[model samples]
Target chain A: MTIPLRTPDGRWRLWPGLALIAALAAGAAAASGALGRYELNVLTTMLCYLVLAQAWNILAGYGGLISLGVSAFAGGGAYCVALLASHTGAGLPLTLGAAPLLGALAALALSVPLLRLRGDYFTIGTLAAALALQAWVYNWDFAGGSVGLSVPIARSPDLAQTYLLACGAATLAVGAAYWTAYSTFGMRLRAVRDNEEAAAGLGVPTVRYRLAAFVLCGALSGLAGGLIAYQQIAFEPGGMLGPGWSINALLMCVVGGVGTVAGPVVGTLVVYYLLTTLLAGYDAVSLVVEGLLLVLIVRFAPQGIWPLATRYAGTLLVRMRRTA
Target chain B: MSAAVVLNGILLGGLYGMSAMGLSLVFGVLRLVNMAHGAMLVLGAYLAVLITAGTPLPLPVAGACAVLLAGGLGYVLQRHLLTAMLVRGANGPLVATFGLSLIASGLVALRFGSDPVSIPTALGTAGWSLWGLDVRAAYAVSFALAGVVAVALHLTLSRTRLGAAVRAAAADPRTADLIGIDVRTLYALVFAVASALAALAGLLVGVAFSVSPQSGTSYLLIAMAVVVLGGIGNVLGTFAGAILLGVVQTLAAAQFGGGYRDLVVYILFFVVLAVLPRGLFGRRLT
Candidate 1:
């Protein structure tokens, strides 16, 4: 059975969808001024996670490259902002501007080696790269060693501003995902993901397509990291470049739905609220619940909650129509 | 670098090899990268520590119990969880195991606290001089134990009916099943044996080096490096790869600083994976 894209009729709907998203994002940003500090903080954090989840979805869901080292890019971006701010006394705009570039550059360099690995090996390779980056940062005196570095408070964006930046980033991330969903590029990518050999045999540049997705995801992850740096102010390698980032991204993507454009958005909200907000002080319990959820999701709903819910809803609609 | 450091590295490699063997076995048979392998090792270590510290049991007895328990846990995990996941697709087992690792580590941390702990034994601190090179008693014992296990495992796989069945199953599950071989039972048995080996390695690691609940990831990375270097599913090659990794790490630490050791290993792992996906040993068990 050939499954069609969400909008397979034409690209005409893309313009309206883009405009609607822009309006919604602007509306959210404008409405954020009325939110208290706690609500703002939570929303900002969720937005950042939305960016991460979306970025991860682009790579793993569409690209078919299950990277376990997303922290490498996210941390790389945060470090870029931190170092730029500290060393050159760069403004927030400049620091944020450089973050995605740094992330993209790093992905480009690593892609040569990383993209060579296939399937499970690729996952292992990305994981090693992240840990290696962390270990290197721990020993490098230039990057403040294990003590970590702080973003210049004077140059940093305040909570409200950080939220705006995160909103913008999340919008871009979602836009990217939407584009990948309907565009010919995304179709080619899905083709590569579904069957590399067949795509290659059909003369698709599989490696190039995969690399493009990898780099694009890296850029988005880095932007999210930059926003995180602005929000946290003082961050360490352990917190920034830790496995937690990868875990969070993976959990959000898997739980929501893998490969679906709307999955990460739903996943980010569900996971952020269910695990982070509800179980704030209970670290162990949170982890246990998170793990159990992951296992259960993969076992029972491997296609993820988004797809499962939609499928069930479709069936229910069919039954109602038949009865009518 | 002193001769002693290299000697110590070789000794440490024995434990690394033993730890990696289980991971390799699972990957070789099930083609599933058990992301919980390191967690299983940590669990083994914690269980041994709990038994020895809370009870009057000797360290050896505690170690044996931990191994047995780990094996049983592996059996259940494979039979119930992983066996079902295997049919779904590739990502199912990987994600499930990742979740399992999280659960294992979280549970361990909740029970034991996050602080690093080790089993204090005379062997841990005692030393012996062999040809003017100092070797810790724990290292020596672990190395010897690893060698013995390797030899025994080799013999079992090569010289027994069970070994033949396992080999046949690994070659092709469907074909073996058609020929009256119970592939599911054999898989569980293989996973159990692998878990037992990992537990043995964990016990040695606990005695020789401290382990915390979060130590599973590092151990998992080390096991992955060794498995890749030794060639996946090649048991003997795993031992050799572990030794090479140990030597490389030790030398890198000596050349740079102690903090850079993991950095070097991870870099090496990435490079090797990119360059030699088949592994340095260039051997396939199946």
Candidate 2:
């Protein structure tokens, strides 16, 4: 018997989009050898956030669970290296390898209690928990307190290597998103998001799917955090676990195209470029603009700018050519 | 540990009740979370602080003006920005409010800097005794005011014709609209009232404790707990939730430590939400 390997909606057509990102990453790697120190750092940080946005997309966009507490998982990922350095003096590769696993464990712990809260309560619950954990981390000496943990300099990756590592993670993240867009697992997540009751009635194992998504997202976020730790060399709790990181991910995922494979990637690049150019060195102005931009996008383009552009781009281009 | 702590807890809860009231009311009527509610409350406190600090206005007078201005601001927001958002869907409004909060906090930070700015009033520090319990003058006043506002709101919801229209809309907006009750206007009025309540709570919180530009998020967290605990949309239940939370917090603080209060409160909040999400007195949300 023949088996179907695609979602009924022909989501596989976007596989080319995945290949395009792969090609771009290859191009970015080849060009990174000649880039300056500042450009290297900026690009690496942007790629880390790109991974975060893609991770957030899987949870909120596909699984229909919104969380602003992803920093907790990211923090878990970062601390893997920190803890190892403080206690065991593990090298960069080993510490980085442990991040996704630690992050998934942290997410699993968070989800058991978090998932029990229904509907909108999850939003506030996760936020409160994250903040509480942050505060607790400030007091706990074992976790390096609020001063935060440092990666041992001897084991740190160089700028060029860090950029390539970030590129690797970004590729994995985008691949995950692309897989979700076309795979049965992603279909179940989308189903649970659209209507939990109906999906449950259809024997979709909604909670399990949701838990799996949360864990996977958490692991991905952890990987991003680990990459940042390697890059920054010594990062603090405020820098890593602050609401700023979560807010950036939210802005990128929503504005780019929530639930679409290319949305978070597009959103990430667009927002990163905008922040660097338009609101550089102006924290207050950035907050104001980001907030306003987020509101406008939600109100004006609920499905997000990238999705709308994709829908209209072909027709608009054809019409322009005809007029010309 | 003592009656004094219990009294202090209840007094502190007064502000939380009103803070949650605004969020609960909007949720009841519109079925949407007001992510900007806390920012709106902070804005109210800022207005009160500005008038009290910069102008020659008395604390009470400044507070009153803040309340009225906030109510008017609520009307404008509901009628203009939110009305359009609400028509889109539930999630759209959430993101919209989230954005509103970001803008509000950013503006506050830009205008005043991130320093703590309290009402230049001595209401919280000034103390008095009644029935062998020590009470701050401001806390006493707020506790009494909470009583008055609670009774006023309850009576309005129960007895007034205007309130009846709001209730009808909350119960079933489509039916109320079909019955020619002007659901949109009712929603606008409800939002205004809720916003005013939030501002009043903000004013009280500023006096009883202290308010800063960034104080919005903590108050918002507590409000969510109160709303969740008492039930979403039930006014009296919100106060009940707030009172319980206050008692729990103070007790936790006394027994464990101040740092543990948030740990305890948030854990309890999560546990309650997990166990009985409808709240002790709230209706089924879904």
Q: lDDT of all the models against the reference? A: 0.88, 0.83
| Top candidate, metric lDDT | 1
Chain B TM-scores per candidate, in order, are 0.97, 0.95
> Which residue ranges in model 2 land beyond 4 Å of their true spot?
A1-18, A320-324, B284-286
lDDT of 2 by residue, A194-278 (tens): 9889999999998899999989898999999899888988877776777777889999999999998788888998999988788
Model 2's DockQ?
Answer: 0.67
lDDT of 2 by residue, B228-282 (tens): 8998878888888888888889887988778677676678777887678678985
Q: What is the clash tally of candidate 1?
A: 0
Q: Once superposed on the true structure, which residue ranges of model 1 sit more than 4 Å away at CA?
A: A1-13
List the candidates' TM-scores in order. 0.96, 0.94
